[model samples]
Target: MLFRVDPASPVPLGDQIAACVRGAVAEGTAGPGDRLPPARELAGSLGVNMHTVLRGYQKLREEGLIELRRGRGAAVAGGASPGRARLARAARQVAEEGRALGMADEAILGLVRAALAAKGPPPLPGPGDGRP
Candidate 1:
């Protein structure tokens, strides 16, 4: 996966690194069992600290998107699918934002349930002949 970070952005570097992997998985560029570059090496290339890469990897581990093993390094988790990775990342965002807003766990869950019950994002038009 190609990792990138904006040093000036409000988002943390580690989180940006994690986002790269997550996006790769979501877009099917990376998938289950795909081995990732060594954290130390990736850090060198990204010009960030090794621990920053590790922290990103740890976040992926917590999200069940990747696995970390001694000597073997990190690989995409066997259970991770493109859809699952995207959903997991989205869920984490919702939960984090909810917590930041001082929402209780049950309230956050309720919000999710309500959303699930509603019509979702509008479907993209396909083969349209009218609007530009």
Candidate 2:
């Protein structure tokens, strides 16, 4: 997977790093069980602080996209897949924008529900559902 960041961007470097990983996951280039480059190495290569890369990894961990192991470094979580990663990114963007707009959680959820209503309700995905 490739990691790149724009130092001049208004966005934090850590967030940019996280976005790169998310994009890789969504593109199916980095799948479950794939090991991510060590934070220290990635930081060196990207010319950012190690903690910055770590913060990015932590964000992925929070999103359930990747897991940080003691000696094993980081790997994509088993439940993570291209489709799920894509939707997860979209969901996060929606929630962030809603919060930035000062919308209440219920109101935000209601909006999501309304949008989803066009599909007439979705059943929970199960095995062999082909969601990824």
Compared with the true structure, all predictions reach lDDT values of: 0.91, 0.91
Model 2 steric clash total:
2
TM-score of each: 0.78, 0.79
lDDT of 2 by residue, 1-132 (tens): 988899999889998998888999999999999999999999888999999999999999999999999999999999999988898799889999999999999999999986776476566667677653
Q: Which digits, one per residue and each the tens of the lDDT, describe model 1 over residues 1-132?
A: 888898999989999999999999999999999999999999999899999999999999999999999999999999989998889888989998999999999999989975764565644435673522
Q: List the residue pairs that clash in candidate 2.
A: 83-132, 84-132
Q: Alpha-carbon error at 64 in model 1, in Å? A: 0.7
RMSD of each: 9.8, 7.9
Off by over 4 Å in 2: 104-106, 109-132
Q: Pick by TM-score: which candidate is best?
A: 2
